[model samples]
Target: MRIKFLSIIASFFMVSFVITSCLDNDNEVNYSPDATIRAFELDTIGYGVNYKFTIDQVSRLIYNVDSLPVNADTIINSILIKTLTTASGIVTMKDQNDQDSIVNINDSIDLTKYVNATEKNNFLVLKVWAPNMEVQNEYKVNIRMHTMVPDSLSWGDKPIAENPAGITAQKQKLVTLGDNILLFTQNSDKVYSTTIPAGSPSDRLNYGQSWDSKNADLPEGADVTSIIRFADKLYLLTENKKIYNSNDGLTWTEDNVLTPDGATVTNLITSFSNSDGSNHKNVNGIASVIEKDNKKYFSFAEQKETGWNITTSTEVVPAEFPTNNLSADVYATESGTLNAIVVGNTQGLDSKKDTATVVWASEDGKAWIPMEIPSNNNCPKLVDPSIIHYNDAFYICGKETKDDAKGFQKFYTSPTLLVWKGVDRMFMLPGILPPVKLEGGVIQYPYSEFSFKGKEANYTMVVDRNHYIWMVGGQGIDKIWRGRVNKLGFLIQ
Candidate 1:
């Protein structure tokens, strides 16, 4: 088909040139054979032009290698050529009837009509004339523009692809290790993992490797729910009030940090990182809460060369502090400031008529500070919320118990951890999609947008090294999905 299309245009060029050169020749003078359109341009677009229009002489086509924004299609309807450079030839548009009109740089041209129509020359044709009076032949003009929103979050319909681990468990977590990500699922004291390979953060609908046995197991008393990554090692607290470290996610070893005196390990908070260059002895550590004498306290232990440097906060853990089903992580802001935050449930939220989720921040891991958020209807009861710092903002995803919304609804985002706002439009969850049916079969609504009737268990959202948002597993929905903002997938990012 491509060969046939090119032959037709080639024949047109040959016939047009032959007829003009074989004229009566009353003057017997020479005419220049050059009839090339050197350049063409519209104004700079919103995202700026990453590529310019390339004139392909062999294919007789003029196009932009990279696409313009979606509005560029409409913009071309009345857009004047801001720059049109030819080989000093008179440019004109010829019709089917052979009637022609001169084309000027200021004249608007509609490029969207009959674009991608290769079977015929039914679209507008811009011709360049040689020194002679006759015009030259066919050179199709094609401009490509994006069909999807550049910044809006795009998700797939439903699972037509393999669900990495192949089994849906009641709970799962995503852990990052440099270039790869691990999806860890626990069931009946047996834990499994699937490694997701790393690459560019483009439009990836499905991602994950086959499940492996991992060839490792946890200690008899190690808590699987409290495992966290600290610096280069994975740490978890055991039932003996001893903190254990593991170079790999499996095979734990005893560490120096213990739940001192008679306290038991409550839970692991998060890993705190130091990005401060001035601190020559830049240290990293893990934070946790321990209960002793009926009072819970914040505890942090720094990773040392030989042993661990433990520090327990003197301030008593507040009653409003999140205790269970917590999600936490450390992320750096745009200005290079590091932040460690934890968000979950506190027993007192049921008694309050305001928001249900609580947030706390820490600098050195030991001193915990509550970040105040607006107490309003915008903040829902985000039970088992998974918090992630992505694209410079923090996003919380979980089940909404307040109004009884379905499908893990409402992802709240905040630039500053203190102020959060529910995203009603842009960022949304993957909608439930049904299998495509025959001509007379029925399809479902909420196919690709957020669905309130959909069913998906609470899951973890982890950002990969390349910044792709990876949805690992829901208790009921064992699916691996990778998504990224369209602009973030651009080469500029």
Candidate 2:
């Protein structure tokens, strides 16, 4: 009886042990060998030309895990985020739930501390790891950052063909008349017209037929310096100080109303007219400073029933400027105000070069007052700068000497034309690298000189009615390129 009882006890103990082992096996958590990223999401945010991302905008890095088991002793060894370009510094990532804590699989990570405002075309990469696992898998996520603002300039696929053989192609000027763009050669009455291409408004310009010179009514061999449209007539200013008016580009009428007095008309601009319907005309024309008999004078012309009436103001020359050889480039702003930026060298009391640059502003284009321009370290001395009122601001494009060794072309913008700010180099036109000629007799790539003097003389830029900025024929350069200006005054793409 004692042996039977012992056998029964041993059997009962074995059954109890078997039950305990089964329970333990059933309750055991199966830790996945490989973890999976279910979803990686970034917050949608808009960007601008000069947008600086704040910490809150880029704080969230929401992600979901598929195979990570809850209540399991899964240890995340490290979480790293970096840009694909440098891959140098480890991005500072923190738990979104607890700002001071490190990032974890359960919580989203803050990514604001990692992003930079200056860097563009950037790709962000995230790498996560779980240590001491059987598989020891590393998970990764890649995201691309995009600019919310449209590019200022995007090159088109079509390339403008070279000028027909033997055609005298000098510097070209773009004059926008309604829907068509007229290209006039410097020092020639010949004009060529092009219509804006179909499709996107950002499409490249398409050249049309060249106009007959017989229809363009100007003196033979007259050098066309500047052109402007006022009211219902198109006016052309010649280097010899002659004004020609045309109802249609086909037939021009010489309006010899303004006697240039031997001073060449360098610029022509029309002021904004009063909209009260009280005035018969809404536009006023102003010519650049003209030199006559060794004295500089500002000329004004008004369209009337008979012809354009002219008036000259000798007092327009600022007292600080050299009375002789005074030259300037004039631009009319959207507000109908005229801004004259002195271009040539100014003379001191001793008749030498003056260091100060002068800028004058006028509403009526007759009475002018000097504007205060603050000195900026980034504002370089502009050489023969071209001013255009575009994108709600004034853009001055010219060359500047850097480190006194090399000179490069740059652009500056001013909201009120009183204070100017330089744009970043990344925003400038690309594909302007120095030219290289290949062995096949094909010019590899041609570049323009930073300075617009000597060999680079006649390098010019203009903005059309469509807000498309064009850099046309320069001395020894027949290449034409176009760009767009954003509302924020940034030249893009």
Top-lDDT structure, candidate number = 1
Model 2 lDDT on a 0 to 1 scale = 0.44
Per residue, candidate 1 scores C-alpha lDDT tens digits across 1-493 of 0011223444666686677668854535555667777877776655555447788888767776566676667666666667767664466665444555556666566667744444445445667766544447557776655665777665555532344555565556677754446555554244445555545554443445345456456666665556787666777765666778777676678865555666777888887655322233354767888888887888877767787777777778887788766788777655555667888766755466536565788767788887774556344667677787776688888877654565576678887776678786667765533346567786533454333224557566667665667675555665666666666665433
How accurate locally, in lDDT, is each candidate? 0.64, 0.44
lDDT of 2 by residue, 1-493 (tens): 0011223434554576678778896664443433323334332222212212222113323222111111111121122221111111112222333222222233333433223322432323332222212332222232222232343433332224332211344645555565566666655555666566554433333443233233345555444435555545667665455667776565777775555545555445443333212333344554445556766666676555676666778674664542322223345544544454533233444433233334555555555665555455233444444566665466666544445523334566667656766664323542343346788887664434322222233444656555667655454545555656432222222
Candidate 1: RMSD over Cα atoms? 7.4
Candidate that would win on TM-score: 1
Tell me each candidate's RMSD, in Å, in order: 7.4, 15.5
Query: What value does the lDDT take at residue 315 in candidate 2?
Result: 72
Question: How many Å off is the CA of 399 in candidate 2?
Answer: 4.3
Model 1 TM: 0.70
Q: What ranges in model 2 sit over 4 Å off?
A: 1-152, 156-171, 187-189, 197-217, 238-240, 248-250, 259-283, 287-294, 304-311, 314-316, 319-359, 370-383, 399-408, 433-457, 486-493
